[model samples]
Structures are given as structure tokens and as C-alpha cells.
Target: MQRTPEPELMDAPEQASAYAAADFSAGDQALIERIQALFPSGLGPRVLDLGCGPGNISFRLARADSAAEVIGLDGAPAMLQLAQQSLEKEPALAKRLSFVCLCLPSLALPKGCSGLVSNSLLHHLHDPLVLWQAIAQAAAPGARVYVKDLRRPPSPEVAEQLRQRYLADAPAVLQHDYLASLHAAFTAAEVEQQLHRCGLDQLQVAEVDDRYLEIWGQLP
Candidate 1:
């Protein structure tokens, strides 16, 4: 039997470009609700949102628990600036949130961070292990890391349906984002394989929507 070739994932700039118009606020909100449920009160976890564009997810996480200090890190300065501006509009988030511009491949994280979260950022890397290594160094002992990624190898029919359903309703940029994300997404099996190869298979992972996946692990 023959198999289909997987669509290629987008590189960094393309991924960022797609998100230039993507509605991260709504998506992040929904995702944060689930994340919030998984944690106990007192907001003990200091959080980091890798590839945090415009600080949408960072702001939401900070707002979810005022006591929790949240940092939004991205490679793009423009995105970080936008995040800064966005937060400026919300005085409540002033003290609790901050943004940093840094390249992920050379990221230097402070020791003993409580938690790390990356949303839709894994597929942009050629070496996912680079990310895993960084995640390991940044997290405190038993620190929780949650990553939300898109699942790839979507059936032709399903991909088309997504185009017609979600893409069509989105703006031109968001339409592009949806398409790029589809191309960049990895299959659940593929993600599992990659995680195992990266020595992160022990993490508890879950599949959400047909095209959405999440992984949560602790640094030993």
C-alpha cells in the first residue's frame, strides 16, 4: 500500500505572518479555560507563553489568576511591541504581565519557572527537540508544560470542509493562517513519535479537535 506525502510545515516568518491576522484572543480564551481547570487556586505557577504573539494568551493567563506572573516571549519584535501596546490598554495586567523578544533556538530561561505553555508554535521548528531542551531548562522541578499544536494529515475531504467552514468565514489573513496551519500541523501519531524520539513521551498528551492536539508534561 502507498501513503500520501504530508504537507510541508511553514517556517517561522510564514507562521508569524499567518498569525498577523489570526484571531488568537478567542482561541486563547477557550484554551486558557481548560488550562485553568487543570491547576489549583492561588496561582502558584509562574507561566511562560512561548511564541506569544501580541500577548493575547499571556494576558489571558495573567487574568485567569492575578497572582500568577505571566511572560510572553516571541522572536518578532513587532509582535512583542503589539503585545506591549495591548497590555498598556489593560492597566490591570500592567504588573502581572510582560513581553520579551528572543529567538527560541538561543533562548535563555530563568531557572525554576513554575510552568511553560506554547500554543501552535511547535510545528514551526525544524528541530522540535531544540524546543524540548529549552522547555526542560526553563521549568522548575515537576514544572508543568502545556503545548497546543495542530494535528496534520487531515483528510482531503476534511481539509476542504475546514476551508469552507472556518477559512471562508475568516479574513484573508486568517484564511491564509488556517491554510498555513493545516500545512504545518502534524498527525497525532507523528506528534507521538516525535515526542518519544525527543524523550518526552512520558508526558500526558491528548487529542482535541480532529486537527488540534495538546501535550502536558513535567520536567524531571
Candidate 2:
């Protein structure tokens, strides 16, 4: 299927709120487990979660390690608002977890992050290379990288089927965004090509389960 890019940022208030309210714990936990399995040495001293939408993964990262600092960076203020609110409630994580409101393709992204990870952030970019370049520039020399996103299905029918199978009972806003994200997602092969183009061919891209792609490896 041809890629159809969605709005890069889910900055709208309702959109952010609905997304924050949705229950993605199952998949979120799986992603975290996958990251841990791939890099058993553990994420380095500093971890950056790109497109951290409400900081679900960010919180997990912080809690998984007492010493590691986790930064959740997203372009949407609305999402970050909720993340900050959640952060405020967790006094223990107040110092280890921080949320930053910054869009991609900017020099402002932290330099030399020991670990870089993102989830479902790939499909939203109008220019996919923005993600690859950002990862390359932001990562430390031997950073561990693990990125997971929905893979574009073969057709609209398949995309809808996946949505209905997994998200039939989700909120209407979430369902709509889910379908759009499926269409906007890239295939495993495409992501492999993207890594090659970014001079990051060391990373491996693989299609996962029914509708996801994963990229993982240590940077050079």
C-alpha cells in the first residue's frame, strides 16, 4: 500500500486527551520488554523516548532503572501537559523523568543520548528521514536503538480489519486516529531502506506479528 502521511503532531486538545485516556498498556509493556530483551545490558544512563505521547513508555523507563534519567520528547503541548501532570503525581520519579515539548527535525534534540527509543512515531512524519536523521544525530556512539511502529498493510481493507480486531471498543477519536496511522505507516522493507539511506545500515528492520515493524541494534 502507498503511504499516506498524517498530521505530524497530534497537538489538538481533544485528540491528545483521547489518546492519553486510551489503554495501551499491553502493547506498551510488550515494547518495553522487547527493548529489554534486545539490549540486556540495559538502557544507558540517559534514555530519550521520542514522540512520547503522554509518557507511558517514559514512566516505564524511569521505573525500570533507579539511576537512569528518562526524557520524553513530543511536539504536542497537550500531550506533554498530561505527561507533566502524571509526572507531578509520581514524586519518586519527579527527578528522573522529564517531558520536553519539541518537534522533530530540530537541532535542539539532546545530543549523545545513551539510549534512543520511539514508538509509533515513524508513521506521522511527512518526511520519514526526519526520524532517521534525528536518531543518528541524537544517539551516543554506542547507543542502543529500538523503534517500533505499525507497518502499512497491503490494502485499506486489511488496515480496517486490524483496527476492528484490536480496537473495536476504543473511543471514536482513537479508532479514527488508529486507522489513519495504519495508512500512514511504512513497511519493513521501506524502513530498512530508510536506515540504509541514513548510513545506519547496521540497524535491522523486521516485520512483527500481524501489523508492526521493529528496528533494533546498537549504533556505530
Candidate 3:
């Protein structure tokens, strides 16, 4: 499937709410586990979660390391609002985790981060280089980076097939978004080219699952 760009931010309340309500436990948990493995111990004392919609992975990162402070950055105010509400529910997490409303490629990071992670965010970008540039700017020396996103299927028929197989039970809105995302997603080879173009060839890009691709490694 050729790349089709979606909105860069999930700023609409209805869209954000539907996405927040969607059940992504299996994949989310798998991503958390992989990130944990990257550090073995933890992601150091500070972490940055780019495009952290509703703070799912940010909270997990905080929990993975009791001492780590996590900053969840997103361009969507509605999504950040949901994340803040979630933070309020977990008083302990509130201290170690916080959400910031910031768009990517700005290069004005909240702080020099020790680690960075992003989930399902790359496909939304109109220009892939924005993400790579942000990553290079935000990361500290030797910061661990992990990014996971849907891999564009070989054809639209395959995308629809995967959607029916995996998200058949989801709400119509969620299902629509999933299909759009799949169409917008990059193939593993495309991601490799993006990484190389961004001068981040050291990062490893691999197809981690039938529908997902992962890029992970440390900053040079």
C-alpha cells in the first residue's frame, strides 16, 4: 500500500475518547516488555515518550523503574487531558509521570532525556524526517530509543484482512482509524531508508510482528 498521511494529531475529543477506550493491552504490554528488556534494569532516571497518546506506555515506563521520571509528549490536548485524568487516578504515578502538549520536530524538548520511546505514532507524520530529527535533538548521549508502529501491508486487501482479523470487534470509529493507520504506515524497508537518511543507521529496524515493525538501539 502506498503511504497516505493522516492527521498529525488526535486533537478531537471524540476521536481521542474512542482511541482511549480501545483495548490494546496485548500489543501495548508486548511493547512495554520489549522496552524493559532494552534496559534489563531500567531506562535510567528520566524518560521521554514521544506522541504518548493518553500515557499508556509512559505510565508503564514509570512503573518499570520506580525511580524514573517520565515525560509524555503529545500534540493533542484532548489526549493529554485523558492522560492527566489517568495520572490523577494513580497518585503514585502522578509524581513520576507527567504529560506535555508539544508537537514534534520543534527541537525544543522539555528536557535532555535518558531514554525515548514512541508507539503507533510514526504513521501519522506527513514527513518522516520530522520524527528522526526530533529523536536526535531530544535524546541525550547514548540514550536508548525504541519506536514501534504498524507495518504497511503489501496490499489494501491484506490491510483489510488484518483489520477484520484483529479489530473486527472494535467500534466503527476505532476500526476506521485502524484502517487509515495501516494505509499510512511504512514498510520495514521504507523505515530503514528513513533511518539512514536521518543519519541514524545504527538503529535496528525489524519487522517484529505480522502487522508491526520496531526500530530500537542507542543514539551514537
Q: Pick the candidate with the highest TM-score.
A: 2
* Residue 23 shift from truth in candidate 1, angstroms: 4.3
Candidate 2 residue-wise lDDT, 5-59, digit = tens: 8999998999988988888899888888889899988989999999999999999
Pick by lDDT: 2 or 3, better one: 2
Question: Which candidate number maximizes lDDT?
Answer: 2
- Alpha carbon deviation, residue 11, candidate 3 (Å): 1.7
Model 1 misplaced stretches (Cα beyond 4 Å): 1-24, 41-43
Off by over 4 Å in 3: none
Candidate structures ordered by TM-score, highest first: 2, 3, 1
RMSD of each: 3.6, 0.8, 1.1
Clashing pairs in 1: 152-186
**Residue 135: error of model 3 in Å?**
0.8
Clashing pairs in 2: none
Q: Rank the candidate models, highest lDDT first.
A: 2, 3, 1
Better of 1 and 3 by TM-score: 3
- Judge candidate 1 at residue 155 and give its lDDT: 67
Across 127-191, the per-residue lDDT of candidate 1 in tens digits comes to: 66666777777777778778898766446567667777766866665666566566666667777
TM-score of each: 0.84, 0.98, 0.96
- lDDT for every model? 0.71, 0.92, 0.88
